[model samples]
Target: MASPALALIVGTLFAQTARAATAWRFEPPSTSPTEQSGNYTGFSNDTINDTEVVEGKVFNRFVQIWLENTDFDDARTTPAWENLTSRGLLLSAFHGVTHPSEPNYLASIGGDFWGLQDDDYYHIPENISTVVDLLEDAGVSWATYQENMPTDHFYGSSYTSHNYLNASAEDYTFYVRKHNPLGVYDSVSQNKARQGRIRNFNDFANDIVNGSLSQWMFITPNMVNDAHDTTTDFAAAFIEYWLFPLLEDERFNDDGTIIVLSFDENETWDVQNHIYTLVLGNGLPEDLVGTTDDTFYTHFSLLSTVQANWGLKNLGRNDVNTTMSNVFDFVARETGFENTNVPEDARPLLNISGFAGPLNSESYIPFYAPDDLTAIGAGGQGVFVSDSLDTSVTYGSLGESTNLTSIDSQSPWIVVEDKSEAKVAVFAKEGNGAAPVTTNMLAAVSAAVIIAAAVYL
Candidate 1:
């Protein structure tokens, strides 16, 4: 094995090469031809880029670039967005599943967000499966890239980067764990192999040049770049500086790849969860270029589209809810999957935020097991139920379970301490079946130990 001195020299050289290729300034990233290597990796052994050549019915690669909290009108009217619309199909009627950022992001991959309402950190129970589980099952490579994340598999709440724009600048909270969807799920965060796949922008640069890009990628820019803490204009410019050039690179976007550019949720919470969305890549038909699709699509559409394209199992939640999660029109056409047409009046109030769900509020309920029997996916596969799921009861029946005696215990939104440690589920012992109580701290560490031992050992 190489000594520490040798490692340091190699690291310094790689960083220098990455800096030169990216053409860094006091701004967002630019295009790079080869490896964009840096200290942004998780473990030295982490597989940030797990590449595979899986063929799909429609697109082989699916890349999701997420911006934050911009209304559909605001994004559409932005001068910077205009430049991007001409290169791909504009999804005029696309909507976010819920308000705030985290839930919609979770919904994008895991079929359902499990009712958690705010940006507070919380990990979904392991029994819940995600797109990563499906992809790996089907041999489709996937990974997530957070722009300014301190490390690849970081599970922290937030990190400030004084060196974001320039070294002399005051450190700012450029990265937040709430925005990184996979980090919120225990199945992903706790799994060593999968956790290593959570990389940063620098790794993205490295992945491209190494010819190691994954087939499925979820890319989240830093707070300022994603408009979470900045303006849509700033985000548009960042995209123009970064993603715009990559659109031309076949490694980034080929005829077999589909790139989704979307906002996490709309700024206007009063309106239905309408958000600006764009679909690009050479995978898009030439005839569809610069055109508009008025289909009623949601974040879950991406989930359905990917599953349909790759012939994978469904998570059996909103992803299978045809009315709520319609497949992309072009993808539907190619895959022989029919897109759902919901009447304007019959649509659910998507603007509805925080009605209390799993791991949400003070009266938090147990995570539900999906009904594999009914969750039929567009790929013609049933739901993929994990071994850890509690099959003794029906899904979402926690509130009615006889194990809970108190009225407070029956409530779905359980109150807990507001501390910011990683949220986890503590399965409380009942006279009968167990009920889950979520607490970040101010609870038994032994319970987690017992649960961990029970689940893993």
Candidate 2:
């Protein structure tokens, strides 16, 4: 062997070379040449110009951590979660879109589930543009960090086996493709450049140390750590151990960084489909820490919040109407163009039956009906009406003098009985008809118009 001094020098030189090679630095792409050449070839130029004109909360980075299968009550009791809540903004009324986990994950990044209800290995078509497309168009970098994934861009139901139980028991590879929503989309999977961004969690540390972190980063823990195959305490411990350090790191905390920690869905379907959602980072105001925001939000709201901060266009889905306004103060004025308040009837009720796949069939048929509209008590004529903007009308059998609360509206209504059946209608203020047939019909018509506006506006 060579002398100790010589060996030490060689080792130091190798490490410096490695660091130099892997150092992550971001340089904004040069669009001046295209502009100078008089080649306004793509929509990016127009998007940049339009978005810059609007004043909004501009964030340097956004990081999201998605946990799995934990109820809001159970998750809040954990010390780790409680600690995070004390340091961040807690969303009390945040909810998930649906059950069985897959659709919620898809909705987080893709705006819509595309009618996905099961956890099968799905290949979404290329025509469907995800939030990744939006990020790229806005000149922002994005990536997905999944724990225990076999390698970068790994695409499969599970890393090793199709069966989750077998994979968890045999190899301890709990990385499931259902949790990796971006990997399933053809827009990302088919494109080599985008697929390369789906990296294992090990790369997260390397990127951080090398200063290569992207503008938008999505993180998914393994099944065991995320509480899917384990308990809430276990997931809590995992988060505290892994995330607390990053929160303290200057690389992630500097320059308006926002971190969102949320669960994919609730454990039980009987209660309101609320899940734990926490927003904490250096970007938030010091006074706002530990504040509770009781905003009616969903996964679509999270997507919209990011778009609002980055000045990106809506994906023309639920995100267009479901923007979260209460979290960021500047958001309300910036996103005035969007219909931030989603009507109570417009929201999809968590349908557990939606997860019921055919016994023998390989694929699941998407169920369109909302499960929250079950008949209750001795039924009469019941109509579920939208409180804000009179957009939706759902006619059903109502019980005797039942009080139904609108999800979006603070207005209260009491059911009254008519001769044939209890015709459910909006509660009149001073002097209004008991049940206005023409108004109810108009409400249905307005729903169609609002839906059209949501799609194209």
The per-candidate count of clashes, in order, stands at: 12, 1
Candidate 1 lDDT, tens digit per residue, 119-229?
A: 765667667789988999999998898977878777777877665466565667878888898987778988987877888877777777677889999999888788776
Q: What is the lDDT of residue 104 in candidate 1?
A: 89
- Top lDDT hit: 1
Q: Which stretches in model 1 have alpha-carbon errors above 4 Å?
A: 1-26, 29-51, 400-457
Please write out the lDDT profile of model 2 over residues 1-457, one tens digit for every residue. Answer: 7999999999999986875564222211112211211111112111101111122265678889999878899989877678768998887778888777888888888666654555655555455567887677667788887766766776655754233333234444467888998977767877887777887665665566556777788999777668776677767766666777678887767647888899989988886688998888887667668998765788887777777676675555556543432224334344442334545455457544342211101222211111233321011111121122112211111111111111121111112234255232323222334432233322322343323223211
Looking at model 1, residue 31 earns an lDDT score of 35
Task: Tell me how far candidate 2 lies from the true structure as C-alpha RMSD in angstroms.
Answer: 21.0
